[model samples]
Target chain A: MTTLYHQPLDTASRCVRLTLSEYGISTHLEVEKLWERRRAFLLLNPAASVPVLKTDDDLVLVGAGPISAYLSESREDRGAPLMPVDLAARAEVRRLMDWALVLMEHDVTGVLTHEKALKRSIPADHGGGAPDTAAMRISRDNLTWHLDYLDHLLSTRDWLAGERISLADLAFAAAVSSLDYLGEIAWAERSACKLWYARVKSRPSFTPLLEERVSGVIPPAHYDDPDF
Target chain B: MTTLYHQPLDTASRCVRLTLSEYGISTHLEVEKLWERRRAFLLLNPAASVPVLKTDDDLVLVGAGPISAYLSESREDRGAPLMPVDLAARAEVRRLMDWALVLMEHDVTGVLTHEKALKRSIPADHGGGAPDTAAMRISRDNLTWHLDYLDHLLSTRDWLAGERISLADLAFAAAVSSLDYLGEIAWAERSACKLWYARVKSRPSFTPLLEERVSGVIPPAHYDDPDF
Candidate 1:
């Protein structure tokens, strides 16, 4: 079995976890206090991000994109393929994944994480300080634009992205779930996106993530509720 | 022939250009003033980002990740394989590509582009004003950490990532080139990275990119010099 080092509330980590579970590859989940910045953890990922997977062969795969790609290739027998085999479909899937990672994750989830999580978690040496007000305001305003874009996409397709469920869907779901935990999602204004998120939140693989409890922080009451 | 909507100074756009050229896939280059936000361009990429490729079949691939993935899958022969066939290698490559897109590009190249290009090119309706000084400062300070990390990585590996040259290398090269155009790279402090970049900048596929001149902005005198 492989070992996955991650924080409970990390959207990127949870994204990798869901992809692994979908592939039926069980990993030893090691909850890492990223703020602690242990030397051992630094060796695993110099960028100091997670989730980092240590394979059975001792190969360390860092970052969500690589880990998902590795598991999708390693366990091809179980579940629907995380990435499409067709050229055009695969490009679309990759495009959506990039959007989730670069656009949504950066613009929305990043704000919440920095404002709510990092501000509380950083060590003394790590410049534990107040979040940038301007950046947070920009992030908040940008959320409306992003959610509207999501609504437009979901209106035309059943999923946030492609016709079939993909790693992209899972990635976006993880980000949304994290934001929901922080009560940052404007659910009322994004009905379609919220409904789409409800379906993703109800998946069996998502159960473990929903049940995840971050230390000193309580998730929203509706976070675990599939009907939300 | 496919049409590539691009701006020459844009690294993400250049990454797609290199991949297309390497695959011997001829494309009609349409230089887009990305800041202009023309209706047709916005229709193609809602995010208003560049490197959008319109295929011969009329399908549009948005972003560098999708465009590179599409070209890799669409072109069976020509140049070295951009992505590996082996699953582990492929995952490693993808992870590095993600690092460039999400980490380096967002933090480093994005800052430079906004400060050097976007701020100057800001159209009237977009609330054209001076650049965000605080954001630019943070971005500038963040580059040293990233450059040092890249220097450490390249100390052992010939490429920015895995063994053979992959999309990761191209993506990193593209980002670095964009910054270099703005004369932002501290080359003396990043000797190894500079050496690695020299090899990438010298490639035939990269030469055309070096020769490209943005309308208002001029690159460093040594920008086109492979030895720089």
Candidate 2:
């Protein structure tokens, strides 16, 4: 009986949810509106972020990195490890995952989310004013650049890091999926990335993410379509 | 022998150097001026980041996250693991490391480095312009806030994550050390943080980082002093 505190459209939370599914771990989901900064949630994560997990033993874990690493260290009955057994391959998995965590999420998904979703929800006095169009444009260009890089990688590798699905795939897929939900990805422009994403979409783990809905925001028509 | 591509005051590179030293691995150091964006360096890391490790076996590991993970998965002869063998403890270590990487580095060190060092060294055309005073002020406040959090953690725990010295310590100490080199940390204001840092600074693995010299920028007089 693990409970995961998350927000539906939060990219990090989505990544954790996907990792949990891949590991075949069932968790009770609780939505946390981080902006509200609830006292109990703040105690769970002083950083005031989402995706805090409480294990069956009641050990609390905060942040996507901790949750991802914990889930990857599998026991015999849980599932096969999401991390590669080989050392070098494992490094690649971590490298790709880090890239997604720092570069993709921070630069791209964060930009899009702030502009597309968060701006409309929170009040202006709390630093949530009108969407910064200039920032969004730059992020869009950056997102395209990242898509080119992903396409280059997908041309050679079946998964983001290597031949098999790992946390890297989960991370990259989660990042792109968040922007896709906002209708920001130019899928037709990058055939390799589209093909790779289509494969990710078919996975049962990703199904939960597609079904998620924020309070007042509706996803684009192609948001949940694997064939799109 | 391994080769590490790094910049002298780069926090991520310093973290990797500390990790490698902790594991007793020797490597040739190559200072990469990231702003220069060398073609070969870009080949090694498409992300154009430093602390790219080329192992004796020719496996290239980029970023502190991957490099730390690789170093921690040590064989008996290499060294004892810097990560705790227990699953929950390992998660705690990783949680703190990620907090350092994402919160401390992104918010504080990046701002200070850009303002105090890299801005003067790199050209305006490459996006290195005059330091924004408002941004620097905000970052300074953020740095103080983080130092307070670090002090709060160290008040009860022997190390940042736990009693044992782990990669969490290395990651956080590296971040603060870089900022300390720039004379940004107010040691007098936070006694506990200063005490905890003194312990980290005295470690043999931290020796090389203290001795490093960037080409143009000079660190403060007390930068290398373990007793400071």
Candidate 3:
């Protein structure tokens, strides 16, 4: 069996979980705080970030980007083909996946996670003082634009990249879900984004995400709901 | 011929250039000043980031990650295969590529560029102003660790991912080269990293990079010296 080291609320970690689940790959789940930078974990991944997937063959894969690509590419027949086969379409999927990893994660999910989760655990001197409201405001402001963009993309296509679900959808869903957990997603106004999220939420792979709870942080009541 | 929209000093763009050069792909380079977010550039890439590759068939790739993946996967027989065919080896290459793209860029080159190059352009209201000495100090401090890590990796492997030069090496070299151009890389003490970088810098792909000039910033005298 493979082992996936992850943080329940970490956006990238959630993405790997969705990918693994969508592939129907069973793996041991070990929650990693990442910031602690444990000695053994650092040995496993010098970057000390997760999710780290130790394959059954003992290959240690770190970072969501690598793990997702490895899983999807290496196991062609094991799961639904999350990456499209057509070269142009595959490029589109990869493009959207990069968008989620770079832009969405940085501008939205990263800010919310640091503000809502990690801020409570880190010391004030380490630059984790009271949540930086100004930074959070900027992230939230960017969130509106991102959500609107998603709405625009979804207006013409069923999924982020095309008519069918791909890794891009899962990646976007993972990011939005993290912000949604923080009660940051204003769903009523962004109906298209909300509808897309509902579809993603209904998937069995997303079930695990809904059950995750971080201490001292309460998710919005509708965060895990399939029909909001 | 494909078209590569890039910024001369941008780390990610440099990586794509290296990848294209390695593949012997002829691309017309269009320098992009990302902060300006030109309307036409935004249409090509709403994210308005550099290293956007528009293929001959009119498919527009918006980011370095996607562009590199496309170029390698599309033209497998065009040049030296930068990505390995074996699953595990390919995964390893992808893993290190992500490391350079995400961690290295964020911690070192991104900070140094913002401090050294980008700060001179944007207004204070848009989060650009005088160089942040504190941030530069942090980035420089982080650069030491990064160089050490590269040295450590090279001690065991000829290139970052394995014995042969792969996209990982190109990606990392692209990042460090950007910093080098700003006189940010301290070469003498890190003799191993310097030696390894010399190998990358000597490539024909890197020649174009050495010729690049940003209007107000001058690279160190040794910046383009492959034998340095």
Per-candidate clash tally: 0, 0, 0
Model 1 regions lying over 4 Å from their true place: A76-80, A123-137, A186-189, B76-80, B124-138, B186-190
Q: Write the per-residue lDDT of candidate 1 for residues B37-98, one digit (tens) a residue.
A: 88999999888888899989899999987888777766655534878778778877777777
lDDT values for all models:
0.81, 0.85, 0.86
lDDT tens readout by residue for model 3, A56-108:
98999887778888888877675438888777888898888888877888898
User: Distance from true position, residue A165, model 3, in Å?
Assistant: 0.5
Best by DockQ: 2
Residue-level lDDT of model 1, residues A34-145, one tens digit each, is: 7778899999887778889998999999988778767766665654477777778877777777777677777877677777766777765775677777887888888888
Candidates 1 and 3: which is better by lDDT? 3
DockQ for each model: 0.68, 0.82, 0.72
| All candidates: CA RMSD (Å) | 2.6, 1.7, 1.8
Docking class of 2: high
Residue B47 lDDT, candidate 2, scale 0-100: 92
- Residue A218, model 1, lDDT: 87
Rank candidates by lDDT, best first.
3, 2, 1
Interface RMSD of 3: 1.2
